[model samples]
Target chain A: MENTIITIASGKGGTGKTTVASCLAMSARQTVQFLDCDVEEPNAHIFLKPRLTREEAVSLDIPHVDHNKCSFCGRCAEICMFNALAVLADEVLTFPELCHSCGGCWTLCPEKAITTNRREIGLIKSGSAENIHFTQGELQVGTATSPPIIKAMKKTIQKNSLVIIDAPPGTSCPVVETMEGSDFVLLVTEPTAMGLNDLAIALQVVRVLDIPCGVIINRGTDVYSKVETFCRENNLPVLMKIAVDRAIAEAYAMGIPAVEAKPELREDFRKVLNHIKGVTAGERTCCH
Target chain B: MKELVVISGKGGTGKTSIVASFASLLTNKVMVDCDVDAANLHLLLSPKIEERHQFYSLPKAMINREKCNGCGLCEDTCRFEAIKESTVNPLGCEGCAVCSRICPENAIEMVDTVAGEWFKSNTTYGPLVHARLGAAQENSGKLVTMVRSQAAKTAKKLGYDYIITDGPPGIGCPVIASIGGASLSLIITEPSLSGIHDLERTIDLLEFFGVPAMVCVNRWDICPENTEHIKEICRKRKIPFAGKIAYDNMVMLAASRGKSVVEMNSRIIDEIIKVWEKVFEVLCPNMKL
Candidate 1:
């Protein structure tokens, strides 16, 4: 079988994205490469418990101006889209946190005074947990951008390995960055009104990206059928339904993967993986 | 006016649900939902859109094929790898305008694109401010800042006493933009290991900004030990600990009905009311409830 990249994302937070991703990794028969792309508030590390053997600082280049060489033309500040640069009568100010590292300021500088300086925005940590190869990104607190760190983490994807990505909540840039190149996306949601609402929005993102996707209803119950109705109307497959189990919630509170807490769950997760493989395989054949 | 932002470092810790309940309890406030990415507050509030404004953030690069010489300078100079064969992929482009500046044929134009939309609406509870960012759009922090400033303006002009904001999850740009300069922040956390871990990081962010913060553990009975651990950490850090809310399925039922827990008849309603009272007391020490 070829390598498959599966991303678990939810439009709302705390809907069990990490839970599903980690459990899926543990249940996979072969070695798995797990990337926790939720840099801002990465919780997969707590669940995966990978013995981090490597750490690398992810930095972006921000413009560093040399006053003696600068003509104070203010061209760099004027052209900056992020407002990271500002020019005063005698000095120029650069806000490194606000810089997007687009190389606009220095490249456009006529006086050649603006040079690049490395600003560490986050760190990428990699290690292994048993058969699972784990990597996660930690965005520096108060840093405005997470995409740079997420981009750095994606660089470590090993070829021809089962890759599972735990994406951040919400349908924003960070989520988009994680789901961009994935083979299949598993959207986890609950059967509640808010869950149905956000799930619809997240589906919009998947549609825009044109990726094959499915849904898993966590804390599943018949009390709220809207989520199921929405999924049926959209023709998205319901891969798995993990009912509202108190033991699972308790296990989660103790930093335990649901599959580990109840070994029977491993079979359920494995079945979900098979379904995904079949879906992706069908797509590849049709394209050819 | 004092602004009280309810934030949870972890998503699904009941921030929006609690805020919806507070909307029913609080009389003189304009509620603002700062979660522009996938906003859920509007679902519960049932807001009637009163004012709508297009939010323009970073400018995206647009190529004029007629003016292009096909020199491929724009593609080579682009750092984001956004340009390929003189065509810019909107998803990959960071909207930095470097291609426009470096284009030899002057074909690229930095065009202002609407990233999202913000709205001022009237709800049964009171006035509400919210926004919806376009799918796969960037600069959510900018859109969040816009929603907040609009809320503040509406609050001040209408003589509202408070700006009750429902903040986005995480300690990122959007969260920072929502809580900065706020009078107080209420960090809602669940009684899980992930919840506590995220809560500590959120507190560090609030401390970094000098924003006064309080802690409220939702579904505290889910794990009593972890809940106590969270309270101990709050005590050590000198942060006020708001009341704990018991785990209840009724909250979900109420949400499905588009109602706050306070509006529904359940034991959880009183607990939520108590939590709101504690937050209100800290927000307005001198004013009467």
Candidate 2:
């Protein structure tokens, strides 16, 4: 059996992404690797509540000052590209937050006083609930970048069963980092003009990345035909639609999956999953 | 003197529409669109670029072929795989300068590259600060800070007293950068499954940073029960719960025409102006207006 990696992404936010992702993760609980890559505001954990068994720190290599071997030359400070490293008449300041861990100062210093140290930006955590093996990352507060922590989270799914990545919202770098290399990308969207424009941006990103993608129009409405028409004209498949149901909202606020709160949602989500399986299987059959 | 950042943990949740309304209501307020990755506020504000400044995020490594040594050390030392064989992949190279450090031949040098541009421009309304980034660059949060700071400086200089901004959605770098030194954050959100979920996260982010924030529900009528749930959440968190905006078409009509909702003379604009009044009250408690 091939390990099919699936990514659920919606460029526009607040469009039932967490609701659908959580439902799919719960129903397909047996022997599935659920990786939540929305490290910025990872809400999947609120529902899953997995117990952590493994914890690892994510750090970057930044330069450390050794004043003893240093001349007050200030060359390292002057050469730093990101302004992460600074120098003064009596002191040198290295703001690790500004540093991308480039280690430029360490190499440029003739005195070799510059050494490198690891600074923790975030952490990777892994645990499980029932048949679901879950991992989610949290970028440290005030930290500017999320991709490094996301990279660590993705690494946990290596050689794992049925990996499903719940991507972060937006068509930015973090979203690309999560959706890249997935076997199928499920682009979730709603029925609004802003939703349509943002979906267009997400489509461009996925197409530019050369990933085959399809759409799942959540909160289905007659107005959402705009989305359907866009998908049709672009030759993008419309996989499934979860209607505008208030029960889904209540179920989520109560911290339970929609399928668990309302069994009917199971039928809808199962159809979504089956459609994905059919398409991926057809692709695999062709490859073989 | 005062800054208002419109942020929602969930993107496409009516942040720009709200910010545009606030901008139209408050003349002389310096406007900034901190949603750098995919900025859409300029579409409504219709900003005409007057000055442009390039944003150089990080330097990348370039190996000199004239002083070439094909030693495998540079390749082996690079953790980012920025140096592949003889060619340098600019995207992969994090400008770590590790290869330059490890190379005994000293053939590698790092140079600054422009990641994006920040623009200060004139609009029909007033001054605007916005930016556009190159694909896969990693300085979005920094760019947000730079824009906010510049906007604040401009506001302070002009005695504008208000720096109204539309922050990037989510609680990542861009949002955090938007939150710094702000008097208040006006979180515009919906009452959907993801809206409340993302609000919990965005509120926590603001609280962690010790910034006072309030919530405003867009499309309150679509899910009235969920809107009350949001109100209850605010009650529990001890944060002030602001008013709600009913689902309105006038807002869309204004945006479709590239105009601010406050600029419209329709029924929706009146309700939105009420929301703007609250924003002004929070930002300027002492103002008689």
- Model 2 lDDT tens row, B150-177: 8887778788877888888878877888
Model 2 bad stretches (over 4 Å): A27-30, A52-54, A107-109, A261-268, A271-288, B42-70, B81-91, B96-128, B146-161, B189-212, B217-240, B245-274
lDDT, residue B9, candidate 2: 86
Every model's TM-score on chain B: 0.97, 0.93
Put down candidate 1 lDDT per residue, A88-200, tens digits, no spaces.
99899999878889898888899999999999989999999999999999999888789888888888888888899999998988999999889899999998888988899
lDDT of 2: 0.77
Report the C-alpha lDDT of model 1 over B176-247, residue by residue, as the tens digit: 899889999999999999999999899999999999999999999999999999999999999999889999
Interface DockQ of candidate 2: 0.29
Q: Determine which window of 10 residues in candidate 2 chain A has minimal summed lDDT.
A: A279-288
- Cα lDDT listed for each candidate: 0.91, 0.77
What CA root-mean-square deviation does each model show from the true structure?
1.6, 4.2
Task: Identify the leading candidate in terms of lDDT.
Answer: 1
Per-residue CA lDDT of candidate 2, range A1-288, in tens? 777788988876666677777788777735778888888777787787788798888998888888888887988877665678778776778888777665567766889998998888877888998877889887776677788788778767757367878888776668877876787788888765656666777777677666667888876666436777788888888777777666665566566777887887777776767677776777422111
